[model samples]
Target: MASPPVILLLVSLLFCIATQRLYAEQAPNYTFVKEASEVSPLQGRFDYIIVGGGTAGCPLAATLSSRYRVLVLERGGVPYGNSNITRLENFPRTIADDRPDSPAQRFVSTDGVISSRARVLGGSSCLNAGFYSRASPEYVAHLGWNGTLVNESYPWVEAVVANVPIVQQWQSGVRNGLLEVGILPYNGQTFDHIVGTKVGGSIFDAEGNRHTAADLLEYANPDNITVLLHANVHRVLFRTRGRNQPLAYGVAYTDNTGSTHRAYLERNTRQSEIILCAGALGTPQLMMLSGIGPAEHLRSFNISVLVDNPGVGAGMADNPMNAIFVPSPTPVETDLIQVVGITPFGSFIEAASGLSGYAGATSNSDDFEPYLGIMSPQIGQLATYPPGERTQERIAEAVAQLKVAVAANNPAALGGGFILEKVFGPLSNGNLRLLTTNVSDNPAVTFNYFADPADLQACVQGIQTIEQVINSGSFTDFRYPQTSTAFLLNLTSSLPINYIPKHTNDSTSLEQFCRDTVTTIWHYHGGSQVGRVVSPTYHVLGVDALRIIDGSTWNFSPGTNPQATVMMLGRYMGVEILREREQS
Candidate 1:
């Protein structure tokens, strides 16, 4: 039996969902000319021409089309109801695929570094962790922006997209214990009251699917957005009027057939603009190809210099992460998508709640600010030992407890069970550099991890915290044994600082073990930055009508997810462009 209020609420929610789905499923008023050949070469020039259909490009097109004739060019195919877009059900399994649908999934650039950008119509949004994290207050203030976390940005992003948490039922017991014992003690206010904590574990859509940009931007009236997939842009064609003055006319692009063509927005008859929403990699590549970068570099590439913006591509960073492993107690049966974990103060809760005043928090999206972890009966008792040996003891105890729990729950495993592990955490600084002048080449990326000692310390703290939680007597008769991801791999001395020269079979130091075993979470950012490459208006310095509006333009990599910020800029910049038009 359920309370009347609860039942009514459920009914209303279901109704709203059904209506929204129905609205999305209906075809737009205009019949889309799917084939490129259908639209004549001069099908009346549009009011706005946007390149790249990833994070910023998609939303920009959607918003601009509200009042203007907008055309969005995408180098990849469209992604809708495609398993390739929403296939990331498990966190561990998300990284197994090489062909992620986002920009970051692409080949290495000229710099010999892996450039992760998707060629699909949905861009990298089709290939991401599906984890949502908002920009922090401290971060906004540091960037010299006046907008509060609860006021301007987060709320705006929530309105247009779905960012609910995906919970995993079976892994709650184990995850909760880790939060209670390990993370809470050290991080004090860092993880408390964040958005990621709402759902006890990972959350899924009502249909049990991962949420993505494609999922969010599926508003009615698809006629406004014509996603031209497999249409890669080679350059932005500009006409020169004077010695120093240049006018942006249209863009030159290549279709899937490798044939070059051009498209333009209205110039004099209508107030129009060109938005370079081609993401970090594509934006700069387009600029350089259009001769809008450092004069020296452009000359090297044999490109005619248009705007000599020295900061076109520089200042790169990313989020580095480490993993923690645990053994399950029982035969877990629920989804293990993503478990919520918390700290003490306003950390996880605040993110979930949308800063302090609930500015970005919305009722329509799944509220996942509280349930941040997973647990199971399989997590048993603690094992005690000497200071250095405590790690081993705890591992053994957890393993034994899980064996018994699994046998009791399934009886088919004969006391044998699987082990659980966490993959990522916070990051340190890293960088990306231009490998060559060729746009076809990949850039050289250097993670430069452990370059800062704090990263290593965080990892050590993470390990110690896990040990403390398992040993805190939260579970019953458990035999905590000891085996570490660091120790088992014999990666002791490979850390940035503790690289000691040793012969084969040399013993590993404790510090070496910690460093060698850890890996990256793979959230790269900031190849081009504000106050460095582009201005606050997102205009690349010295360019007549060029702007960069993606995660790469961020001054600092955001603490949480980057999609909302990227999308917000698309909306905000679109307004800026409109305002510029109004004044002119």
Candidate 2:
């Protein structure tokens, strides 16, 4: 089952040498990478074409590159060197940014929840808390995937990016708090999504740096992979044979310059494929945009129906998050999610501290919103000092030294953390529909969280469970404004902690709290369910030479965060495709 040690070592060295060759094209730096503007019309087609260079796209492209020429078209720019993406502390700043070039693109779901999606090369992985957990064995069996292959696929991704986080004080307290609430046996430091409370992996490293899906490109044979940035794919081109289903042959996309370019599969090879690794939102929207959704919906947009599959934009699910802000009198360490409690009630409990990196006490001050700009306000504050404290030259020196945000850790410096519960197995689901012909515009979607009575009861259970944890001995000391007999519970707003909904009143129940405070944990899935929109093997139904391999194709969102499984699916599909080709 294994190759000899010497042979394995030799193969590894050869791969290293090949990688060097790719990055070595410094004179034409990023020879394998180019802005869509720099790339001319394709003189040659590729063996495989991947759309969306985010979380799944990059890995899928890399795995295919080992044996086939692959092309990746990404709408957003590269993620390298972008501080908002590379630095752990800038996560809040990154997500808050809504500028045209911002890596995180903001979109409000029809559910009235504001959320953001990944718009950079690494996709949402660059913007998320970087929590990495594999889907449970149950999830794999439910999807009917090859269990062995799924396990094999994850290790490669983890080796590339996952890290054992240095669980700091705040996260430790949260872990203890979870145990106090009786979430059950603590499974320490594992990446598996099991039935107990556990500390999982993250993409953020010990040095507080991030490694995104883009990093997985190192596994590719660079000579066989071409990546184009700022390439927004508009539609998939199809060719129909007489009395046969239509086949995908190519894609048309636009560059930043507004010029359109087309890339196609290699001529005369039925093996060639055009895969959609775009996330849930993008994948389904693209199908509809390319005329593969419900006939009535496509007809409304003047798009000719190719497949008329109503399932393309149906069954949208988002894990609803109910969270509370916990303030600490004593300083707590800055951190993102580390420990998670997998409750038997179909909820996952987690926490994050020190976001926004404020160096003062946490407050309800309206002025706190200014930190949303993050660096600018602090940099401006750096300029104001007593005459003796800093002369103009001294200010300049201080400013230069502080430019890298060396002090931005421990948002708990403001003295708090966020304890959040995300509902798993949410019964409520919704749909996605086109708003405009523009591919860049967000298609309207509604997750309809808590639409089902069971879902609301689950959220209420999670809230009541958190109340017990807060009242527990392990976390009681962390509650700030200790002046009260207990908590400063407002008549209108009570339970858990501070800054709750103003609409909550004396008679408000935990169910009311669940509805009033619901937000997104960003693990969106469905819209293209297996056995509806695609084959179990990921091929798009009613079409040939096309596949959809992202969270969009999932029947349910798996694990605490879906990034790990999304990245794994990319690798799993690539290996399966290659294996099938070899066998053929």
Scored by TM-score, the top model is: 2
Which lDDT tens digits does candidate 1 get at residues 1-584? 89999999999988866754554344334333143434436466777778877777776676676667777777765554354344332222222223323333434322222224566655665655444445556666676654642345445555645444433323344355555554443222221125333332111354434444444345413655565666677788887866365667788876656567789868764356577777656676677778876788778767889877776666545443333333333323323223344333211211110000011222223321111111111111112222223243454454344344333553222211111222132344444445575444555555555555655665555444444544544422221245344442232222221122333234654345444443323355665578767787666665456567787777555544566566656666666666677788
- In candidate 2, position 161 carries an lDDT of 91
Give candidate 1's whole-model lDDT: 0.49
**C-alpha displacement of 213 in model 2, angstroms?**
0.5
Q: What's the number of clashes in each of the models?
A: 79, 3
What is the overall TM-score of model 2 with all chains considered together?
0.85
Query: For each candidate, what is the lDDT?
Result: 0.49, 0.77
Query: Against the hidden true structure, what lDDT does model 2 obtain?
Result: 0.77
- Report the lDDT of model 2 for residue 583: 90
Over the stretch 1-584, how does candidate 2's per-residue lDDT look in tens digits?
Answer: 56699899989878855543343222223468789888978769999999999899988999999999999999998777676677666566576556677787767787766667888888999888889999999999998889999999999999999999998777787789888878889999999988778999999887667888988888889799999999999999999867489989999999989999999999877799999988989999999999999999999999999998999989999888877666566566667788899988888888877534332223333223223121222222213342224343554454344333324533223355667789987789999999998899999999887889888988888877766776677886676534231232231133211122336465566777777667677788888889889998989999999998899987678888889998998899889999999998
